[model samples]
Target: MRKFNVFIVLFTLFSLFISEKAKGFEQAGIYSAKIETNQQQQRIYGTVTDQNGETLPFVTVLVKGTNIGTTTDENGIYEINVPGNVTLIFSYMGFKDYEISTDGKTKLDVVLLESTVRLGEVVVTGYNTVERKHLASSIESVDMERVVSRPIIKLQEAFAGTVPGVTMLQGSTLPGDVPASISIRGISTLQNAEPLVIIDGMEQPLTDVDPNQVKSINILKDAAAASMYGSRGANGVIIIETHRGTTGQFKVNVNSWFALQNPLNLPKFVNSADFMRLRNEAYSIQGQPLLYTDADIQSAQEGKTPNTDWVKEIIERPATSYNTTASISGGGGVGTFNLMLGYIEENGLNKIEGSDKFSARFNTNINIADRFILLADFYAHRLKVDRLRRNNDGHGLYQIAWRMNPTQGIYYENTDIPNHYMLHNDMNPVAFINEGGTWNYMYDK
Candidate 1:
């Protein structure tokens, strides 16, 4: 590989030598004296020596613009004949490039330091690159490897495990949905809990982005970095950069996962006997008539005869989730192209129903020339949801299940009331489920 690289470099340099001899010199300068001074051109004499006081070998001395150049002799000395005002460049592969004005001086003695590209400082501000020491603001960077390390379903999920001031609050009331609360530097508003999300140079809502498509996520914290973005950045700005291939190689990567989730914080509801006791206490305080007979009262005093576990009945054991993603990317001299497809299946604790999603994405970057670049991207997702129940908030499920009398069975078996509508105002979980009062089918794209 080293030999191949050397060959390519030498071949290109030789081609430049044979194609033309540099000759763009013109009489374009200030006065007649300056023109007269360039009659025979001038000579810049320089000696190259290593740091240990030993003469260095084979240093190339060239004029800045024109490709007219020569190498030092074995003694590490060279004299280049050029215009007195021209710029002389001293360069060695491992040493820093030195440019000097060939005016008002003779015997130029140049000291060069070892060039360290990898250890040298690099700064990334937005999409621009500058020296690390030049930045005055506090900007954080997340590399590609670190972004993909987590088992994240949404692009925002990667931030959950990484950022310090950022907090993620998963919604307990709604399970299969994405995280509802994401705050940076604490919650700034009761109306809006999420920060601003930006992809490339365009702005987007974080909830609309998928993790599989992202290459990195950068969180710009503090006022110094956030102020430039104006009002939209009061919450903070999450910048996302997607992956693209180089000009010659094809890159393919696949990511997939299967997850099982039980409820993180499941609420415990009182059993039928305790519930009835509380209910009787409330009725007594309100001066209402006794709703239960002596036999029902006897059953309620015992811990268990037929107590309903309302929370358990509504929430199933665990839900299963699976996500798959595949992408193909390649490029040549003309341009680069990328295509990706993703599918997700999520099931909630409600055993009868779940949510499914499928998405497709397209991205392409073209090098218009050596100095210009063009990028284009578009993506869309289709979602379908099958839910056995709609949350009428905490009121529907809890109000019904907690108040159902322990004496009554799920069906009206051997009840003296005889009519299903007898307790129309009373909370009944079985009736809510049977009467099709809690079901939903949603399609969003």
Candidate 2:
């Protein structure tokens, strides 16, 4: 019985040794090798460790520029089949990649250093700023410098196509009547899906802020958003940081630009002569009486009658728009402060439509005794929009012009009367905009 027990003990010990050796062979890519293939391929074996000589398990050992690779075992032991004149790369998660050449020798051990890239960059999150690598998968940040340089009249228009997982709603051209709105990636919620917006740590509408003054915009989605503001950030969170003074002498900057606004495309209607001919042809095909006489058609074709272009009469070409912004920023022992003044004037396609806006922003940080700091912000803006009447929203204004008959001119032959009447089916679109029957809207906030 004693001899049999000793035999069992020896058998178990030998079985463990074979299992460990097989695992090492599998990790080295030698388990799949054939006896004849071993004669042509060279086997390179190595151990990957950290700078402190700690073994790094599961490290990848790959032949450079080839899809051949293998992973190290738990003991950091890796063996790969190579062509002798090949380079090998060693990589591990969160560590710098280590590379070496197999210049005829077999053994090639390397130590990998930890990567510093994740430790350097920072990201703004819900409660505080975190390192970029920690939350990069759930957060998106905008490149403000690139976006601010665009020629945008409304600050809301600046975010047209900058970030991913965010959608900006279509804006209006009715001067100050348009406000910017954006929706983040759709969240599974019964409530509204609009993302929560916080500008300078304060709840405010996005349209009220100027694009030039923004320094950074951080969007938090998924778990990163829900853990911050609870249900308020259920859909998503957009945090906006405005430009503040830096530690430097007083610096002044002025930016100005102008753009020619024109309608993208407008419907072209047939002239009066073509309209009469087409109408007569249609009625004749339908076996109905023609509306115009032969003399009228003859006179129209001979250029004796005028072709009224109602669109040109009401719409202005190359509507001029200009924007200017000036800002002063500085800092001292007391604290930092930034003051900016901006103005924008825009002419719409319609003759009676135009807008001018003035805005000023001042933000400061004052250091108190030793343990306190005061942050104060002031923003004011005034807007004036012409012909944006309370009753007429301008949504159907252009449609009326397009549907108007081309037979009537802008004014009557008798110009002695003030507000000379232009009639088209007793409804003239040009008169609604040009006849002093419109209202202007002025807003200050």
Task: Write one digit per residue (lDDT tens) for candidate 1, span 368-438.
Answer: 74347688988777676664353434245645665555544554546676445323356556555445454
Candidate 2 has a TM-score of 0.68
What are the lDDT figures for the candidates, one per model? 0.62, 0.72
Q: Which residue pairs show backbone clashes in model 1? A: none
| Residue 389, model 1, lDDT | 54
Top candidate on TM-score is 2
Best by lDDT: 2
Model 2 root mean square deviation, Cα atoms:
24.1
TM per prediction: 0.62, 0.68
| Model 2 lDDT on a 0 to 1 scale | 0.72
